[model samples]
Target: MPRWKTNLIVLWFGQFMATSGMSMIIPFLPSYIQELGITDPDEVAIWTSIVFAGNFLTAFLFQPLWGKLGDRYGRKIMILRSGFGMSIVVALMGFATNTWQLLILRLLNGTISGYIPASTSLVSTNTPREHIGFAMGIMQSGAVAGTILGPFIGGLLANFVPFQTIFFITGGLLCIASLLVLFLVKEKFDKKKAAKTPNISVLQGFQDLRKVPQIPALFSVTFIIQFSLLSVMPLMAIFVQGMHGNSEWLAFYVGLVSSITGFSNMIASPLLGKLSDRIGSEKILFIALLGAALTSFPQAFVNNVWQLLILRFFMGIFIGGLLPSVNSLLRKFIPEGMESRAYGFNTSALALGNMLGPITGGFISGFITIPGLFIMSSVLLTFNMLWVQKTLITRKR
Candidate 1:
């Protein structure tokens, strides 16, 4: 097998393990906070919000640093750094005696985390240009699959084992992932060449990259895509309840509603990615944005959970096209040595979107109502589609 293909296969599993380990905490986070002796319902909720958002806050700040370092050194080493660092920090979270300790550990984990972005950089830089889209799509599917399964596995393990044990298991998984990459993934980095290249500050790197107009525009698209999709996530269970009424299986139905999109997205990612390679990521991105916007609009009017689920499934198909296309485009547009730095900034945009989406969703839902939030998401997606058309598609034409 080709070296790029070998890297892709290994990195896909590495991405899977990293994402699974990170998300596994979600299922038991609240319970773990309570275990730390925060008994007040309101206090638990407040602490939960703080601890959950802490990771993204630091991640947004730190991803670019790692990316810069990756460009200077090697992407593979950055992946190992993230995987191993996250392993230790997350394992320590299991031993925290208070919410403050847990919160600090979460922030530390975020500060060191860059496995996915680094893996993305490695794959994009190593893979043949023509195959970049497919590689990104496969990588995305791995992450999505991990996201879909993590909560389920975590919830199940919570029933049989102490929550602390789950953290240890997650840590082990992360460690194993790092080990796999260390042994299996091979990256070719020319230190002599990289040394000769002018070393620029991260801010300078950003300024330099912005000179290529498509870089910043693509970053905005990434921000908006994540923002539109995740904006509804925090309230999705409540939305399901509003549709289905109080039922014994509310949790089951909620899980179903949440995982269905990822299922379809995983199914569509590689297929859309392959298509993008043949045609162009720009066209795929435009069509996907339009489809996502159109699908999101009807979700506001859905009268039943089935209708909502069907709409969400279709939305996921379009969503599968969004980020992979963006990744492929970044590869095409970015300067040769700056791939890692550019992707880092893009990852930072992604983290910012992840951080803001739920907060905005929760706050806006009060004024607009739950159903209205769907409309808001739809409108945002529509605006993003127009932005892509004007900035990317029109410029290309």
Candidate 2:
């Protein structure tokens, strides 16, 4: 491989290791909660919601702070902090005696959300401008592939392995990733520019947040899509767990669904992004946002795993493109010097949804049947789509 390819791979692997560990728990949370001795429906719902929301609440609170630190120090340190912090917290997840304990660890995990943003900034900054789409697409695949692979790995592990065991495996993977980044990847900071690093300000992060007029609207668009996807997300394991199958099947089905989505997404995101280069990110984003909204409704109505997987597969096509498009558009808005900080703000918005998606999904799932949660997700997403239509897609800049 060429030097750039080698660097990208190291960063990609690091991101994959970090993100995959975090994602493994998503489909297995309900099962983990079940092991905690909460059997009652209402209590399960509450505990699940708490576990789901804990990550987001922390992520939202801490993302901007991490973003500022990354700006002053370096992207390299931020990535290291996130990986090592998460490795510790996630490994401790195996020790949780109850839902509250697990929630605490997940909250701690959320505080380290800068890994993805930092990695993305590194790619966007270093990549030859012309090959950015292909490069980012390749880099992003690790996260998407991890999401796809995590549930399956998590599910299979959960069968004979304890829910706590999942943590050790994920923690090990992440630690390996962190080590790779520290020793193998090099950060070539501009020493000439370092002396003048601006005032170490979180406030300046906001200036880039506003430097582009469309970001606020674009941010909302992203939140809606993620919110829709996650609304049904929390209940996947719960739904599968209740079916007549054993734990092995739970791993198979949950992993199957997530894997298929990831597999399809891996193909679709870059294709959509490349197409966006031809049409426009605005058009692809708006249309795909609507596609995700429409796709969400059917997932709620499906009766079995097969049906759900089919819907999720198609949903991946629309879902995969949103993040890349969001990033590609930001590359347009961000001040030349502030790619990492700008992504930090954009990431905060997505992290808001990721953090909130589960909590909110848990809440909806607690009150409603698993399928009903999809309707709620679809409704919220539809509102976001309509909001985009009203505020952005149609408006002339």
Candidate 3:
């Protein structure tokens, strides 16, 4: 294989492994918390909800900083740091004796969470321009694949082994991922050019964001898209419980949903990304958002697990291109040097959504039916889709 090909594959693989490890915990976390002796469903719900928030809080705090740093220092270092740091944090979560400890580790993990940003930046920089949309879609699918597979693997492991064992497996993967990335992905620092340039800042990143009208639209859409989609993510285990099932299987079911989505996404993302490259991302955005909003309704009204699974698979098909669409759109408007920072800012928006999804989902699920959360998700996405189509994707732009 060619040297650059090796680096890209290694970079892509490293994230694929880390995300697979990290994502496993989500499906089974609520059950794990319940087993840890938190008897109250409401309290268990709150902690479970707060756990995702802990991760998002850190990502929110550091993403712009990391984005700026990636612009100045090169994205590879940030990727390396994220790979190594998350390895330790995730591994230690296995050893967490209490919910508080788990929360703290998760918070630290979020702060260090930029493996995707780093890899995306590298690939966006390195990949041939004509292939940006397709490559990013395939690369982004690594995350979706991990999310899909992690829960199932976690279900099996958590079934036989201790919950902490999941963390150990995740941590070990991350450690190996770090080694692979550091060795396989070379960072040729252009110190001479960097020295000639002014220092990059978060404010400058914002200015870059301001220059693109499409970016603000993309940023707003990114947040709302994730917010609407993930509203139910935290509550899936609880939903399984509502349907009369044990906690052990939550991972499997969640994995099932994720896997369905991931598989559908894997098939659809490249197609969608390619379509966007041929036509326009702005046009693709309206089509995808509407389909996703339409799909969220079935999850609200499903009668059985099979119904929910079918709806989720289709939903994944509809919305699978959302991530790549956002990236493709950003690439259309932003300059090359700014792709990573722009994507990082977008990821920060996703982190913001991640933070809100769990906190709000947990809080709402405590007060109302988990299914009700889907209603709000649908309503929000509908509003966002209508708003974006009317304001951003108009003929005047």
Candidate with top TM-score is 3
Compared with the true structure, what per-residue lDDT tens digits does model 2 show for residues 269-363?
Answer: 77887787777777777777788778878876666678878888887777777777777777766776677777787777777887677777777
Candidate 3 versus the native: TM-score?
0.93
Q: Judged by lDDT against the true structure, how good is candidate 3?
A: 0.77
Clashing pairs in 1: none
| Per-residue error (Å), model 2, residue 388 | 4.2
lDDT of 3 by residue, 261-342 (tens): 7777768877887787788777777787888888887687876778888877888777767777787767777775676678
What TM-score does candidate 2 get on C-alpha atoms? 0.91
Candidate 1 lDDT, tens digit per residue, 120-214? 99999888887889999999888766765565566567767888998898899889889989999999889788888899999999999999999
Among all candidates shown, the one with the greatest lDDT: 1
Alpha-carbon local distance difference test for all models: 0.83, 0.75, 0.77
> In model 3, which residue pairs have backbone atoms overlapping below 3 Å?
none
Supply candidate 2's per-residue lDDT for 363: 70
Candidate 1 C-alpha RMSD relative to the actual structure: 2.4
Using all chains and alpha carbons, the TM-scores for the candidates as numbered come to 0.92, 0.91, 0.93
The reply for model 1, stretches above 4 Å from the true place, is: 27-47, 237-252, 301-306
